[model samples]
Target chain A: MNRDTVIPPLNAIFQDVFDDPSLEVSDDMTAPDVEGWDSLSHVNLIVAVEKEFKIRLTTAEVRGLSNVGDFIALISRKAT
Target chain B: MIAQKTASLDYGRLVRESRKLRPDGAHQNIRVAILSDAASQQFVPLLKTLFHENCVNAEIYEGAFDAIELEALNPASGLYEFLPGVIVLANCTQALRSRYYEHKGDDFLETASQRVQRIWDALQRHSSARVIQCNYPLPYERQFGNYDLKVPQSLYSVTAELNSRIALYARQRSNALVCDVEAIASYLGRKHWFDERLWAFSKAFCHLDHLPYLAQSLVEMVLSSMGRVVKCVILDLDNTLWGGVVGDDGPLGIAIGPHGDGEAFYHFQQYILSLKKRGILLAVCSKNNRETAIQPFLENPDMVLKYEDITVFVANWENKAGNIRAIRDTLEIGLDSMVFLDDNPFERNLVRELLPGVIVPELPEDPADYVRAICELNLFETSSFSLEDTARSELYRQEAGRRELQTSFTSIDEYLQSLEMKIEVARFDPAAVPRIAQLIQRSNQFNLTTHRYNEAECETMMRDEANYLPLYARLSDRFGDHGLISVVILNVSAAEMEIRDWLMSCRVLARGVEQYLMTRVVAVALEKGVSRISGHYIPTAKNAMVKDFFAQFGFEKVLETDGGSRWHLDPTAYRPPTIYITEKQRTS
Candidate 1:
């Protein structure tokens, strides 16, 4: 899987975790930009992303992500 | 109408369902307070959805994270202020592991268990809410490998020991129950259960995927406490309990034995028989001729469920939903309390679509998976058990015999006399407390005032000899012993004796059990020098059969309200009716 392929599914996951069907992710988007995306729902986002991509994220990898770009990049690297 | 569809425990579906739930005011309202050492935000939605499936609108309160002790010990904490009916104490293994490493002594298990007991004590002292304590799932990392079982100080050993201690302690306390988180973890496999990253990031209890199963177990316990239980299991004959069709393959030709292809059906029969011994009445509904249907039970040498074991056997070419309704009517129980098991999908779906309250579990394709499929559903959750429960089926069977004899007699009086029923009316003893409390919880139709008192409250009433006249009656006939069938609790004052709680088992109805007990109540009132005896009839959905109960007994109506009507009788003017039952002399 590449970055372009991971973006579409990751966008879907964000829309699902936040329960917002119209949600779209941008490169600079962070937790504050998304509604209902708190520390608690962030966990849900990680779980849904891991399930969708069939990859496990380590604690350091999970905590180190800063924005949507970092999330897509991490998944693209590990998903394959 | 109650939804009989089995709710999926899939985490995603439950979460979505939780978001879309609209509160139904017709549903019963329950308050639940969740106190956990880990974060409980993820669990609230799952609990709400599961309770909604059971026709309950749960008002949930999440205690502050890791503040179990702080909230329970303080009287004015938000936990008590919420006025919850159930308090769920969820102690996670990840948090316990941290506490184990920091503790300095070898008595780690003792200290850990004592901390849990102290929390239960404080909760009980402050509020009357039932406590559901979660036992820790054993950690996967075993330092000594297979030798972990030998080390008492290892984290693995301490976790296992704490689980056992939690169950043993719950057995002694009536209000406390154990939610076996370890069993659920083991069933799902421990490797998939532990998600360390999620725990590290958000202090989640388990993998978010498995949280719905945990929530389901709690919902089952809470529902049982609310007096929603499975009282009867309706089974089908064909491939369900045996290997082949009984009509096609003659009784001797059918495969149901301890060997070869029949072993699966044999084991299934054994499981059903065990349920019968536990007081769940068994009924049969099959699409076969009456003679052909019962031939297997009579002729098959290896059959585990005998003909006598079944309370009602209906074998005809009728639709299954109609037969199930007949069974429900004969048993005098709610449709929601019956479980129908049929291997054929057509019959299962027919019952599901028609009788929306009967629990029809989908049977697996193979016969061997029958027991496993039913076991996975955990459909028979209950709150109390007693010796009377074990003898319940036999009492029902004896009732069938009495019914047959009544048909042969000329009048009802002659039939009642021929049975030679003996009744023992005595004060509540320590040994009868469990059955007394169970009767109080389960008796719905015959109950005058449905005051569901727990075992501890029943014991308190038994000990207060001056204020309470808590009496239990046991009936025995030539057929069988009907154990602890009726309970009448009276409140005594200087001027009058009031009937506080009066209920009897529906099995003993029309058998003069109530008539004998009422005679005993009047005699006790006269002996106490009370001027009048008063009782109230509170109306409920199921207790309409007893609406004119006091009026039939010659009591005059004194007060009427929206709640119910009250009746009063002059003790001196009360005439004891002619009852066929003779009082049994107490041996003790």
Candidate 2:
């Protein structure tokens, strides 16, 4: 799976987590961009993302992610 | 072997359903406040959905994460102002462990117990809400491994002691209850229950998948506290009560006993009998010939539930949904109080569509799984039980016989007189507090004020007789004893008495028990030099039968609100109604 394929589903998961349908995820978009994307809900988003992609990301990998692009890149790498 | 738990709502489904909750649909309203020393945002939605499914609209208040003490201890906190009927306090092992290990405290167990008790005491002082405290889950880290159980100061040993202390404390306090988080986790596999990943990420105590189960347990507690429990179990014959259709397979052919497939039905009957013993009325509504249905109960030596066990048995060609309605009318219970179980999908769907209030549980394909399926649902959740429960079936059976006998008389008055009813009215006794509290909790339909009280609260009222007049009445006739069936609590001031609570069992309705009690209460008031006696008739969806209760006995309506109407009577002008009954009391 490429970054393009992962972005749409990942966006849907993000929308569900923040309960905001209008939320759009891009490469530069970070936690601050979303209204409810705080430290408390960040891990829920991560778990939801992991469940969605059927891949388990290491703790270090989750902490290393800077933005949506990093998350998508890691997902694409792990999916292969 | 222990039965496998029924499938729980997945995280996604729970979220979707929670979002769809609306205030307009619920038949009842309850306020709940969930306070936890862990992230609690997720529990709010889960509880909302669960209670909504139970036809109870819940308004939930979630405390800030890791702020249980702050929310509970502060009188000015929003939790107190919410004035919740039920308050749930859940603390995770992770937080307690951090507190214990970080401080190197040897008195961790004692301190933890004190902290939990302190919160309970504060809540009691600040609010009248019933408290449900969740016990700590056993920590996953087995640092001391096998030696942990032997060491008193080990984390495992300390946590275990803390859990027991919490339970013991809740047992002593009438308003406090402990929810065993460890038990729930043990049943669901501790590894699956406590997701370290979720804990690391968001400080969540349990996995999101288990939220629905936890929420279900909490909602059940609330419903039982509110007296919204399932009171009757309605069963079907043919393939349901036994393995084969009784009409096709003769009495000897039906599989029910110690043999192969018969054992399943036998076990099912045993389970139903246990529920019957707990005072849950059992009824049989089936689509079969009366003889064929009656044959199994008479001939089959292996049958666990005999003919006498059933309160109402209707085996006919009529539609089951209509039969269930007849049962509800005859039993004088709400449709929500009955649970219908049938093997056929058609019958289940029909009852579900026609009588939506009736809880029609879907039967499993395998007969062996029947008992497990229903037990897992926790359809009948009760907080208190008494000797009266054991004899409940006999009372209902006698009532049925009385109903049959009533047809012989031309008038209702003559029928009531022929029954030869006698009542024993007395003040609240220490020994009968449990039954009185149970009556207060369970009496919904015939209740005037619908005021719920537990044993401890009832004891308090008994002690404070100067201000509270707590009276109870027991009924018996030529047939059998009805046990203690009515409760009335009056608030007495300098010159007036107000009825705080008035509820009676539906079994004694129209038996002139109400009129007798009212006369006795007025007599007591007049003896105390009270000028007037006032009473309330608060209306609920189930208590419509008692709407005109106060008016029927000559109490004039003084004030009417959206909730209910108030009625008052001048003791000087009151006259007791003439009825054929004898009254007795115990001086001690």
Candidate 3:
């Protein structure tokens, strides 16, 4: 449930949804920072992260998510 | 040693598998467009994974969310330019309910049907894409409760009526198809199927957990439209059709009955029997002593399937892959049409490697879950069924007997004449239009032009005899009836007639049926005072067997190209092969 464990799998999900293998999840990376990550595909990314972490994200939580760092912190807090 | 995991594949598993789907090793290149009123972002990756499993390279187009009408109605939309082979419209109940609330009177169902019809009409005008419309699911409300069933104007009643209207419209329109998403929601319990939270937040109508199953149903529709249907199922004897090894268990010892572990095998056999009844040919490819394997089917009192049910039974000590190749040759069907089921992973893998086209699904470790595992695969997706399909196994079994009887004759002509072959040739009957269209889609090896038509297109040609001559042929011999096995679409003109498409079943090959068809063609030309009869040989991967088909009946190749070649013959010089077969025609 640390940043290292959560970020790698989150980056993998981002890579798959965007179809980019080299896509990396930095702390400040937002939706516009990643190619092919539009509003339509945003739900796919959230559901994938929820699936990987074995947690559920509310609609408010998904809308509130701004960056990869915020997503990692939420996962860490939800995991503990 | 039964595995805990059966066919209930969760959403997480599908997503995990979808992420690993890379562009590699796919043979077919297909473009599919998804137009939806709900969140359809998951369909691309989900369908890509499913298509990748089938070795199809799919370029899936996801339209803007809630833009089904926008993309479908506009002639200049990207969907038209994409020219997808298949377009899936996933209209959710959430959006439909909003529209229903605004509509007045019992015209809601009619208006909804017309809206879908407009999309089909626009697509038909602009592109050749087939439409698959998903019906709305039942809404969760109990205001009227049981009274809603009796009320004709209730929203629930209107939705049910709308589904039936759309189904009826799709049946009339060849290029239109309907996917019963409501059935999927009902099958997977309502509690698990619909997630109100997801719908409220993301506008995802169906729950993400049930999306994979919906994706599976959509995949079946897409594959069937492309004529990628599984025709035959090859079953293993020991540990597959029964609980214990039949070789050691004997007929009495085998576990196949109404109790204990035997019930599992009995249920599996019953499922297989259902498939056979619906025209799927059954065959056995097992490594066992011939009599030992045959004894169980013969003497087992609790056996759900008898020995006569199988079209081709190959039971020996030979390797299953080699035996499967023999079965493919004997049945004369594409390897892709055969599905091999064995309990052992080694045998399944061997066939998978040797015959990549053959569908070899990995069974669960336990015998009790065979039916569930196979049902999940959806091996058979037929568009039409008739009396001919019900007797398909019997016809194939009798054809095998004919093949055996031919070896005793001194010449092929003598064997064919002694069989007393009769062919019923008709222009086109309204009742047989569905079967004719299905034959056009399924026939590959003996197809001359490889032009596939849907029922609507077939019916159009059937109605217009002045310009188009559509003929269907049904063959029967001393053995049994073969039903409608041949179709020819001819473009007629004042001076000449051209064969637009000619296809026949591979089972009736070398039977002089094609030659008899030439006689009919020549007769038509003579009656109409046409100078020439033209034919074309379009080359495909599987249709090379018929490259010289037109030439065999004295038609000369006039135009040749890399794509195909055209053949023509003078009507006076046409010579039909001498075969002792009688022809029946529809008399007005």
Candidate 4:
């Protein structure tokens, strides 16, 4: 599947993570803006993000990223 | 739900990067001011250890003795200034337990308590500040003698005992809680409690060195238990537990076949059962049809808890929170106690906002994390756990006794006799130490003060003449022996007595043990020629069970301080409930 296939999965992840509907999302939205992007929470979030994109984020990469956009870049970089 | 949202956020990111557009104001941060006179050496480690960017974006306001002396913090005189989310009486530990002080026992404890109270009361008066009272941590082995040197510990040891007295005193103030820092510190080994790398101590246990995890954990404890009870624990089925949807795959086709995926789910199920066993009622709110959702319990023999194990079942087409509200109404408990756990993120979040008090723990992708998160919740930690804990599930299972409340035998008196309920109200003696100790640690939800005393401390309080005196009201209703279900600690000051702490177990809450203990305590107060009897209601996450306690006793509201609601009663005006039977005897 092309990168377009990733959109459906990413949409599902965003819907699940933020619990928002009829909404707008940008590649740059990060953990800082996310209401529940907590560390205890981040552990599972990253795991879900990785499994959905069919890619991986290093532990440091996962810890260092501050926003949602960073997650998208990391996923695209790894997936390609 | 998540897989879709993850795509939405990520897609927005791609457009912004390619289009070179950066969005503004994605996350706004809040600052939490941590006030204390603790030296940077002591406080900095705490800051570093608990420095969470997401949960609490905070600033540390390190105050000196002059800060405490400010017009803002002076309770006796100053306008009760607003307080922060967490106001830890941290430096008080050092001042009270200082090696140089050569103070007498009773006076020292009372004075320290008032001093700490002034700080807590002043801060609490502001309304926003949630106070955290910690007992002074004394390195006993280093001070008493060597690591191995043990002594015949005095009844109320200066450092530790004074801290405990302060803890009890703090409990007398509303919405103030005493974190058992002393007991936690006492258990810490050199490297276990403190982090050598960070050179910091865990606030979970106050040691010289600190770990960062302790900070987040402490914040969780402070926020979660402010003034609510976790009423119910709603659960999910299918992949959430045994790996496959029973409808799609059939009962035998499910992944819960013992050793592999089944083991993890089995352990998770058992863990949830244990929480239910502790009086946290269990309810099932699933999307599946009632018959299909319940079929697993009837057909699958490996299931740990059957359909009857659940207190409420809503398997129809309804919003998760709606189902939860119904469960709350049926159980007659609060939505706060309800902890909704579902593998689906959409369902968990729906309940979170609609019913905020209901703790909705995110079900991890892997069953292992799911199990870990449920058990390791420090907010659910009971300071005391005894025989009552393991037996709590059976007690609820047998709560068929509540049905008996409607129809009376003849009169109100006959109704009581029909349901053979036996209550053992005893003066705490050495014989009941084991059970009493457990009650002090595990009984959190209904505890008036939420204070924990070890066996040594419990024994010492009873033995002392000029200090604390404790009494336990144990109830054995028709179901079974509730074992030391209620506790009342009385602080004897000169000729007057104050009920320092009073609470009853949730299981036997409506049975009138408070009346039983109140009458007995008043009698003792009268016998001792105590001028006036008084008690205070200090609020906590779980102790809201006794919010209107003093008013219920007909005690006149004498002095309502920033600390808590206070009431006073002359022996003549006092009248406790006259019901069931009267049996009072002393055990020394």
Candidate 5:
């Protein structure tokens, strides 16, 4: 329910959606930092994240995210 | 395509498999064009993966988003340029909802139906691609609530009406087929089907999780159009058709009827009976003594499927996979075209491991869920139906009688001659076009050239009298009528007559149907003053039975290759085999 618990699984989802095993997420990382992370794969990422954390992200919350830090915070908040 | 159980249709696994897909050289390649109002990008991978699972390599063409009419109406559009064998029109209900809200007309239903017909007409005019028109899944929003049925103008009513119109219109056109996306949505429950957020964000057709089911339906239609169909349903007795074992429980003692502990089995029998009525052959493969296994069908008054309904009944103590192989041999249909349903997991797994091609659907532990479990897979999807289909079971039953009669005679000729068979070989007429096209598509084993000509192509061949002699043969005897059993198309020229396509229904096999037709062909060749008759035998996996077909008819092999062999015969030197079939006078 905290960042420590959310970040590991969130990073794994990122790696899976991008099909990159070596992928790691940082607080400042954004869409530009990841390969194959486009508008199309962004949907896949959101679906995977919702499934992994057993939480649904609202359209506003999904659009409001600016970086990996925002995604982690949203997941941490939703997980609790 | 084999139907997938819901548990195995994992979205993540399918997408990953699609990424790792390699072009299989042995797989038949088909070009498919998808024109949809919704986003088709997510669907392409699902379609590819499902088609690949069926040993078909699909090269898909995704039209620009929401350009169904533009691509269909324009002759030079990329859709026609791709020359798709199948054109899938995925009209999502989400898009239809928007259109329904925007429209301010009283005759919106009429306008919408007419627009769909126009697209089908334009596509038919432009290309020979078979159209797979999808029906709209009903919208969740019901403005009139429970009164939506009474309010004709409501979005819910319009969606329901549109689905019916699509099915009714598709019934009139041979090449056009309905995908029934609404049925899938209804099966999955509409609440789980519609993902509003995904639709608003990415124009997704439905929930990404449910896209594979939609893709499987489309693939079923496409594969059925290509002449891959399940012709027979191989069933197991005991707990499968009825409750408990007939071997020990006795015929009347077994639980089967409309009431009490037998209602579940009664419902299951009714479903199987419906399948048989639609021309799917039903065969009983039980692990019991033959007499005991069949007593329920004869003695049990509550049994919906009677003894005669079964085409090839095999009941013995032999391993079921071997019994199934014998059943396949008896039916002369591809193993892939048969479904084996057994209640026991041991039997299902045995058939699955051995046959691999035969569809073995796992039954539920509870008897009440039997019908639902089978229905969920949608195992018996087909593209064409005719009166011939209705009579197919009777024809196969008579074939069993013929086999019995054959054993009574020492000589094959005597047995064939005893049947007193009559033949009517004539030009393909308008009335026989449907059966003729069905034969062309379904015949695999006895077909010399396995050319799956659609109904449109068959109609063209029927009309082109100047260059083609497309003939259909109907056979009858003391037992029953085998309607339109054979199709032999000949290309006529001044120098020679060439057999372009030769195929026959296996039900009438060894009845001298082919020999009688070949004699008629030689006579026509001599009458027309053609010097030679040429025939080609194309070898497919199923048609190897006819590898030496031309050779038996005194046709000398002229050219040979790995693909096939060409045979030529001098019409003057051809000796017609003595046949028992009396030629019926052509009424025309």
Candidate 6:
């Protein structure tokens, strides 16, 4: 695994996603923390994670993933 | 002879270890947005399990269709709030179809292809993500079919036509894949899909169990086939025992074999056997006394599958996952190679949570359907079955003997020497061109550099250039002769000798064939006075297994382009990995 790959899902999500490419990260952050992080963006992040893992996530799990850590735990759970 | 490895693997159940998912399931985030109705909430869990269950970092946002926030998806701006691999529009009615259909033009398949392409191209430009477009499900046939008159197409046909277009579109491109929602809905028998007990149906618009399962299945199949090969099918016995336990019921009493109730279970076993015949390995992981489970073979007259049929078995209940892991080891295959099918929902869920790579087929209430659904479910992948598929099961049985054959040896070299492996390196001849061409296209894992060629193409390339010299290597050892194990396409020009295509079958890897082939390249180049010999590495999702190939051969890196990596080997300084026996002839 590359060291650069260990970047938290959200930070990577933000950099790969958001228009505010200058987006920096802190764990305390939420989607609400950034601009343009609406419902579609939320789903877009889910798609990004699916692309990243080559695995699928359900809408409920996507909806239930509350924080960056929660998402991290969820993603790490599926990582081979 | 010990030389040939004839063990065949099911392309499915071949476990894929988590790597940086540049292509398949990536380790990063998959931007996903679901556009559906509040009605879809019930089915979301199943969808998530299907699509997101194994994915580590996916963020899915769902809302009423109007809530999609399409403004954020402008690709021309080259700016996006998110990048989604797949964007699904569900719970859509015919009215939505009209709008989508209006934009569709000319080749209906092309229309769907371009729509997906535009979305993928747009998403890819901004962030590395793909797209999946789901065709709206058909309304109940009773209602939708009655309205069509002039066009004479049923609503179901319309849905199918649309979905077919999408499937074709995705099939044509690597960057995008289509999600067949219409087909999924159709698979559910008419009454079952419209108003199931799990769903809370509104009089206005009917729906069935959760949308998540559908979404999840779509995502999972798409990702698995993106490159991962599912190689094996690991199954269990007990209450998963044909509706009766084998140990308790005894072989005769067990709910299996050609009879009512029993026939359902027996047919299920037969279905599994059919898969095995097609090269999907069938292994048993049960909790019966080893001898008792083994007895079914000898005593049970009605049984269609025998002890020899299965590749691996773990009868102890010591955690199904542990047994599954053991099976993976025994086969020298990967966890992804197996899909665990136990009638017990708990065991299924447990394995799903623990070893996520092992696909756990959903246990439906009816046992009769299990056998058939598994046979028909093409979701995970589609592949061209080769002639090798017919003999795969027996091939693995022989491989097991090879393993037992290993225990008798003390040292690795002794084991190799005992096999007395012999290799024949012959100049390419007209008679072998067809098979050689097939080898170039089919060879994957053991390939040092995978360069694909067709029979006619190989023939043309060979005759066209004095620079092109191709050779195929055939090997025979203790086990048997592996027809032709390797092929090399060389460009022998005076200025620069190049290795255009160099590939070897995975069966012969770790056997020092790379050294033999490289030495041939060096010797030929040296004689030609082509001071420089070069090779290239084209990065494919599966071929990443060979990135450091030339480096291992001591080739100096010359250039790295987005196309692939290039390397140079000085004709003067090169040594081959030679120890095995060899026979060679050079054609003028």
Predicted model with the maximum lDDT: 1
Worst 10 residues of 4 chain B by lDDT: B1-10
Task: Compute the TM-score of each model's chain A versus the native chain A and list the values.
Answer: 0.95, 0.93, 0.90, 0.68, 0.96, 0.75
**Tens digit of lDDT per residue, candidate 5, span B1-588?**
344443467677777788989989999899999999999988888888888888889999999999999999999999999999999999999998888788887888988999999999999999998999999988889888999999998999998999999999998998899999999999898998999888877888888889888998898888888888899999999999999889889999999999989999999999999999999999989999999999999999999989999988889899999989878877778998999988999999999999988989889998899889888788888888999899889878887667657778999889888999989998988889998988888999999999999889988988888889999999989777877899999999548899999999997888889999999999999999999999998899999889999999899999999989999999999888889999888777
Order the numbered candidates by DockQ, best leading. 1, 5, 2, 3, 4, 6
Candidate that beats the other on lDDT, 4 or 6, i.e. the better one: 6
Model 4: per-residue Cα lDDT over B1-588, one tens digit each: 001011121222322222222223452222334444343223433442232222333344444433553633555432233234555555434334442256655466456556676776667665465566655556332444442234324222545556666767755666666665555454444324432112111111232223222343444445454333454677878777577888897766676645787888888778777777776667788888888888887888888878767766678778878877866765677765566778888888888778876767666788878876665444364323356656555555455334435333556656555546666666678888777888888877776667788899889887875777788876665545666777788998667788887766676666667777788888998889888988787677777667678888888887766557888889868876766644533333
Candidate 4 is scored at a TM of 0.39
Q: Per-residue CA lDDT of candidate 6, range B264-303, in tens?
A: 7788778777778887777888877887777676677877
> lDDT of all predictions, in order shown?
0.90, 0.83, 0.83, 0.59, 0.89, 0.61
Can you list each candidate's DockQ?
0.72, 0.40, 0.26, 0.03, 0.50, 0.02
Task: Give the local distance difference test score of model 3.
Answer: 0.83
Worst 10 residues of 1 chain B by lDDT: B1-10
Which portions of model 4 miss their true places by more than 4 Å?
A1-80, B1-216, B222-226, B353-357, B374-588
lDDT computed for candidate 1 = 0.90
Model 3 agreement with the true structure over B213-323: per-residue lDDT tens digits: 888788778877677787899999888898888777787898999899899889899999999999999999888888898898899899999999998888888888888
Candidate 1 local lDDT, B1-588, one digit each (tens): 212346567777787788999899989889999999998999999999988988899999999999999999999999999999999999999999999999998999999999999999999999999999999999998889999999998999999999999999999999999999999999998899998888888899999999988998998889998988898999999888898898899998888999998999999999999999999999999999999999989988899999999988889999999999978876678998999999899999999999988999989998888999988888888878889898878766677567657768999999999999999988888889998999999999999999999999999999898899899999998888888999999998548899999999998899898888888899988898988999999999889888898887889999999899999999788887889999899998
- Between 4 and 5, whose DockQ is larger? 5
How far residue B149's Cα lies from its native spot in candidate 3, in Å, is 4.4
Q: How many backbone clashes does candidate 4 have?
A: 53
The residue-by-residue lDDT of candidate 1 on A11-78, one tens digit each, is 88887788999999888999999889888898998888888999999888988999888988899899
How far is B585's C-alpha from truth in model 1 (Å)? 13
In terms of docking quality, how is candidate 4 classified? incorrect
CAPRI docking class of candidate 1: medium
